[model samples]
Target: MNKIFALSAGTLLLCQMGMAQQKMVADKIAAIVGDKIVLRSDIEGEMVNLQRSTVDNTLPPNAPCMIMEQIIAQKVMVMQAERDSLPVSEQDVDGQIENRIRYFEDLYGSREKMKEVTGYSIYQLRERFRQPIKEGLLAKAMQDKITSSVKVTPSEVKKYFDAIPKDSLQFYESELEIGQIVIQPKATKEMDQYSIDRLLEFKKQVQEKTSDFGRLAILYSEDPGAKENKGVYILNRNDKQWDPDFLAASFRLKENEISSPIKSQFGYHLIQCIKRQGDNITVQHILLKPNVTRNDLAEATKKLDSIRLVILNGKMTFGEAVVKYSDLPMAKFDGGMLQNRMNGSSLITIDQLDQPSERDIVLLLDTLKPGGISKPMPYIDDQPGGRNGVRIIYLKTRTHPHRENMTDDYARIQQRTLQLKQAEARDKWLREKIPTYYIHVEDEFKQCSHIAQWIGSIAKQ
Candidate 1:
């Protein structure tokens, strides 16, 4: 699991104290693994975070013990990663930062709101999270490296399942296999031209000093993820998250230069390059998506409905229809099947279908039986760079609640078995590796049962 290091209340309080010129107690070292020191503040910070995150806002009795052990494990992995010279690229770090920032933006509704609540700008937050995220990624990479070769055979999987007591077997909810044939509503050429013209006007205003680019972005940018930050972004030339057209336009500008309206998949943008540092550039932009009119939606719906009729009449298979007509790049490539993000399987539970954005689709799915297809339905694609569209849902299969079994849930069982095998391998590796490194825990935490192995190993050292 990847660990996210969030700023806890304790850290915020310390920051506030510092800003007020108040003297605060210094943080103490709680433990040391090799040359890595885990500070008392780190433990307290995590404890506070865990307490706040729990249902009743309380930490478990053994929370400190658990947290400390996890920290020790992570530190040990980090030491090994460093020793082995594990590589973490700058692009990977930037990607993580972007994802973290996007998550907070969703949570707080906007970057400005997040900054107001957290008392830190997005850039500052990224800088603070940079080291921790990098270290966490390194630790995870090391763990994966250690467990990469561990695999469970068919016999081992059956043995693992047989070993589980009958009463303790896991129960699964009713799951559905769903697929879709999507058609994106496209704006008319006139509407697209209007959007470009509007952005061009905005560019003129910015160049003439009649309006501020950032101010205009805050007011007019449709890129919700960046609007609250005045549409600011620090982008690398090779970052895949950016649209090629937008990226190219951004890189073409000189410092303090504004570009003409550029059209990308997301929409039209007027970009102002703020600064350039080698391959990295900071730019401010205002985005405006072309108006996808009701006519556009109706046209898309009609097209999807026609495709659905052809599939139902056996003139074309659903997968063939997906390949021929679907505009969704990712789903089209996979025959329009919707896979569970957790397990990377097409099987999804009804409860998983209860997400607010998927409620309409769930209702449509309720009317569908196995191998059934629904009429084209309207849905706003909530994905990044998504737009309003119509799609026909395909219900491929649905399974009922059942105990763990080979026939109904072989893939899940196999995954669980493999995980157990990998965990055993990880423990064996740790046992062999820990003694080679310098390890110490605080005297107070020596009572933790899991720490005994480390303590014993230290004694041997």
Candidate 2:
């Protein structure tokens, strides 16, 4: 079976995932599984979407047949999910849709550009995605129910590793696990007042129709995403990711009303409410951070230097220092380790450190050995408001270049072993469950060997 067809880790998100939906004409049924129909146009749409989204316009052979098989599996799982009365909340589905819209808008540079390319308004796109997103959520729920109990043991992991042909073993680069304790200096009261007064002036200009809010944000907002999005955000009331103060300040403003400068964790913001629908609000804002002087940077470095002394003397562990003194709140929970955004692994490579600040820290680890801590170093912080900060680097572990093996790559092997076991379990379930469903395949697609077992029992028309 193609990896796409196997429900190993989880059900794949819908085929059009974040792709703009294109209208289809002259559609015909491609296949039917348990009353759920897969359209020929659906497969074509997926091909077009993949072409647009992928860097290389390349696809596997027999792509249509593979897509047909994948869709059949999804339809069967969705049917089972409904039969089992699995609950998928409308709120969750809506959130995913909204996020997808924002992603595509960012991809195309703006909502207007996205609308021009996709021939759909934001409202129309939401309606178009509703059913597909709901179905995907149901399929994922059923997949989790089926494979939730699957597990792998140490022996199974070794067995999986041994079965891989020695010549085909993957080679890994030198990777490092790094930790840090950062300190950010506070700006003086004079600087804070300066930022607040600047925002108040911008608000007055917008209120007096002397300048545009978005233009001001584009030219002045310190938020990094403001460069691409013009400081615009579609916010949800229940979303905990937004700062409480910022959320409250934005929500209090009526449409077209600009708020007085308000302080949030990031900095001071001047918010202008564009539209609101129930708990969702569309707003634009300008974020400004108070300037830090040379003296302040030196003070922050001195503070981190002291924390480094405590850590080196064994009075406190690096993690303890991070929890007690690091300026970044979330770093404490992660033990100050920089994690790979793709896999959440503490072990990461120079390339995996996408941010320039993170890469700079790793580059400085040449003289430090494993379990060694470096002296206080100043680096620019990469956050919404870029700020100068000081940090001490701790190199936890380092791995040399080597071929895949049981000792060096146990975690990676164990994960792969678990996925294989889950795939087997999923296939076994499908072998039994497929017979119970009313399945039909077009003659052209019946030639796909991968799906032979699925449609073999159905008599030819």
Candidate 3:
């Protein structure tokens, strides 16, 4: 049996549970699957989120019924996962909850602001989000277990592609594969010391009660997020999103204790731990990044320009230069080749290259032919090490727009074919599994045609 369940339990559950706590309306059970209960508030809450998410801010007439079915299906998968003793680690759940909190924090600009908007504190939100994320992970694990052995053949891929109507074939946009060797502008030792000393002074002011941490952050923190977030953040130790140095300093501090000064990729920071619960902690901090002087920028440009000359003169390969001279540690292993985030390939779409942050790269690509390299250009580094730097861009490949074909797009077609076969297997599994579970749907949603299969299982009740 193959199944293709795309129900996102976290999104559905978060909207439902978070809103359910705030609303005073009486809630009723919409359906029951085995020991699991689906509430009317769950459906209504998902509808609310959907309405809020849309461009026109509208929901379909069948939105409630559609959401209800998805929730029911998700609940079924979760219950089955539990029965099978499928394991989802608490650490993984905590990491996911932290990621979700960080997402909302980024949206609202701070944990405090997020609380103000959502009417729930970070701790309360975590408690609400934990179960849903856990359930979603469990459902995915069960799905993987079910589909672990599924595989497709070359012939199967061709058969699936040939069966598609020609008019329905997908048209791809032009994509560019560009690479680079980056050289980050460095601050002099004196400049680094100056920033650290400034943070130490801010720390002293806060400790002496001469200034509030938030006030100092507002005045002095150079972190762009801190400008809006008031330098406050909730972090989980296991979450990799935080800079390692920042995370280490944050966890090392006792509640109400301020760190002297810490250096991270972002720059210098003075941290104060506000609260801690198990693996999660909240902190307020002031950041200060050393100014990259014109001299420093020129130095980096000169270094990269020299490296570019060496590559141009056939003195060293770009990849060898990346290993020996490039400051970007991550690009070294990949031979300085840029990857398409969608498919993890060296090929990327032109439309995908239309990011405002990549505007410089796009402009440079306009003048570059395949295997051509550009002169040193100034750009902002948005990787783990956030700094302004110079880089020589490499135009590896440019793919033109074309219809989906077996030769150029075999991997894409094969993936689509495998998904169809998996969906068929899942459908077969559902037909067999649905009867084994005790399922019920209220008469209000009897009109939803897609849930007819689940509705048929009502006879077992």
TM-score of each: 0.74, 0.75, 0.73
Q: In order, what lDDT does every prediction score?
A: 0.79, 0.80, 0.79
Candidate 2 off by > 4 Å: 1-14, 17-24, 48-58, 82-134, 183-194, 201-257, 271-286, 292-303, 306-335, 341-344, 379-388, 447-450, 455-461
User: Residue-wise lDDT of candidate 1 within 1-461, one digit each (tens)?
Assistant: 22322232223333332232323369789988888888876677667667766899988998887778777777787789888999988778777767767766876786677777777766577667667777777877888898899887999888888899999988988889988988887788999999999998998888899999889998888887565589999987766657889999999999999988899888899999999999899999989999889998889888888898898999999889989888888866678988775667888987676544467877786689899999988876776545888888999899998988888887888998887777677677677777887878889888876677778977887
* Candidate 2 local lDDT, residue 31: 86
Better of 1 and 2 by lDDT: 2
Per-residue lDDT tens digits of candidate 2, residues 1-461?
A: 43434321112223443333555577798888887888777777666655655678787687777777777877888889999999998877877777677657666887778878877767666777778778888877888899999988888888888899999999999988999888888889999999999999999888889998888988999987787889999887765547889999999999988899899888899999999999899999999999888898898888888888888899999888899998876796899998877677898987877786887775787889998888888877765457788888999999999998888889899988988887777777776677778888888888886578766754432
- How are the candidates ranked when ordered by TM-score, highest leading? 2, 1, 3
| Model 3: lDDT of residue 62 | 78
- Clashes found in each candidate (C-alpha, N, C closer than 3 A): 0, 0, 6
Question: Which of candidates 2 and 3 is the stronger one according to lDDT?
Answer: 2
